[model samples]
Target: MSEVYDRLRGEIVDGTFETGAQLVELALAERYGTSRTPVREALRRLEQDGLVERGDRGMRVRTRSPEEILEIYEVRISLEATAASAAAQRHSEFDLIRIRRAQAAMDSTSTDDPAAMAAANRAVHEAIWVASHNGTIVDLLTRLNNHLTRYPATTLKVQGRWAEALDEHRALIDAIEQRDAARAHDLARDHMTKARDLRLQIYREDPTA
Candidate 1:
């Protein structure tokens, strides 16, 4: 049941089962080569996780509204900025190595592979949160990130945004490495602000998005 839950959650997060798409238990069971029992259990867990919800037709992926997106980003910016400041003050060599490795992976990935880039981007952010050593902040940020997965389009896929984001990340990493808490905090906030602006623009341009 846990295996089924993990696989289903991964698919939803990776955009295999898009927002508002029906999640048919029998179909999922067939896809996973299991009985409907496990699939049913998985769907219940996913609902508890807020990834899916019951609808008139059946269970469907949860979609975030524009207002919800804005609220999430506002909270994320505050928490991430605090995390960056704390990480700059307390990070270890191992923490820096993890962050740099994630950045390196992002740099090596082609923009054409948005999923890989997004995953690498997540790695870098999660590394910073871990470096902060604050369980509360990490838990909140993790939930926000999960909510973000409901969006079908990644900001990295926006034209020319990938390069700009890379440069911003480089500057952020530099600030953190230098133990400049103020600089790290500001840079992290600015990065998220830019991302929010870009995402809003994309949403405005594509109503269906």
Candidate 2:
């Protein structure tokens, strides 16, 4: 049931299924080759995650407005900045290796596939969060980040931000490697700040967004 929910949730976040679309249980159950019971369970979980909402008509994919997106980004900046700071102060060598691997993957396919880039992007962030060794912060970041895929990739598509993002990743890794908590926190906050500005700009310009 959790797997089914995650699959549907991914589709919704990644825009494979657009916002406000009907999610009929029978159809989703058939498509996923599962019983309606799991699909129903997935839907319930989706509501808890804020990925879907119950309506008078039925279940509908939630739509994130520009303001809401900005608000989410703001919360992300605060939480993730602290995570990076904690990680820098506490990261193990093994954690640094995992972060490097994720960054390398991002650098490799960055131009080839946007979806893969996004996934790699997530991997890097999660690696840093895990390094912090604070389960509560990790849980908060997990929930806050789950909604980000709603933004069109156009923001990440911005010329050089993807590459710039890689540079930021490098800087973050460097801070963690050196165990410099202040630098890591500042770099992480700066990274999120830049992303927030660029994404908000893109959203304002995208009529379909």
Q: Number of the top candidate by TM-score?
A: 2
Please provide, for model 2 over 27-97, each residue's C-alpha lDDT reduced to its tens digit, 9 standing for 90 to 100.
Answer: 99998999999999999888877788877789988776888878898899998899999999888889988
- The per-model lDDT (C-alpha) reads 0.88, 0.85
Question: What pairs collide in candidate 1?
Answer: none
True-structure lDDT of candidate 2? 0.85
Angstrom error of the Cα, residue 14, model 2: value is 4.8
Please list the residue runs of candidate 2 whose C-alpha ends up more than 4 Å from where it truly belongs after superposition.
14-16, 26-35, 152-154, 207-209
Candidate 1 structure quality by residue, lDDT tens digits, 13-41 = 77788778999999999999999999999
